[model samples]
Target: MNSMPYIDQKGRVYKYGEFFPPELSPFAYNETIAQEYFPLTKEQAQEQGYSWKDPEPRNYEIQIKNNQIPDHIKDVGD
Candidate 1:
């Protein structure tokens, strides 16, 4: 109704620090620790109304080499 809580495109209202319902959560069951402990197959998880996600490939660029960095705090200068 206000900035304290606002309605989403789906008509759901949310506020910071408030607990969100599992069904309304942004994370898929497979993306959370629940999958690590429970460990369900993709078919099983989706059948139970939980979402699953495929792993994404990540590529990071190395900006600096380890040897190029200063080893001590005092070694760094503007």
Candidate 2:
């Protein structure tokens, strides 16, 4: 079982084992890609139409506040 850090539904980090599929390991292991592609928290991910089981869980509010989400993304929902 591989050990990795995962963001929970509450935006909390947790240690997960055997949670991801082997085929997706490359994307999962890439920290840069993870930060860019995945949501940093579960709540934000859910708002973006991703399920709880999705690996990417980021807070869009935080991203917007921090100016992480691009103008295009900001325009889409609002």
Candidate 3:
């Protein structure tokens, strides 16, 4: 699934259709502002014109038959 990227005023990229929490205010679902307000697609937001912040990878997990959990959270039951 290709997620449509949206840039915020702070140059933070947020994928469209994703659940943006209340902590991420000032980011609206208005598509009209995408072109004018935020023209960069996550990859284009560079402060010094060279580096851009990458999104954090989804929770690390090991697939076993069908179960998954973050690597940080160890399962004592295992």
Where does candidate 3 stray beyond 4 Å? Answer: 1-3, 21-78
Identify the runs in model 1 with alpha carbons over 4 angstroms from their true place: 1-24
Most TM-score-accurate candidate: 1
Model 2 ranges off by over 4 Å = 1-37, 54-78
**Tens digit of lDDT per residue, candidate 2, span 1-78?**
125576555465445553543233443323345546654565654453344444577656543454655567556654
Model 3, 2-78: lDDT tens digits are: 46576655666667567663235444322334537756654453431333334568997765543454456566355
**Model 1, range 3-45, lDDT digits (tens) per residue?**
6785555566767776663556688999999998999998888
| Reference-based lDDT, each prediction | 0.78, 0.47, 0.49
The backbone clash count of each candidate, in order, is: 0, 5, 0
lDDT agreement of model 2 with the native: 0.47
Worst 10-residue lDDT window for candidate 2 reads 21-30
* Winner by lDDT between candidate 3 and candidate 1: 1
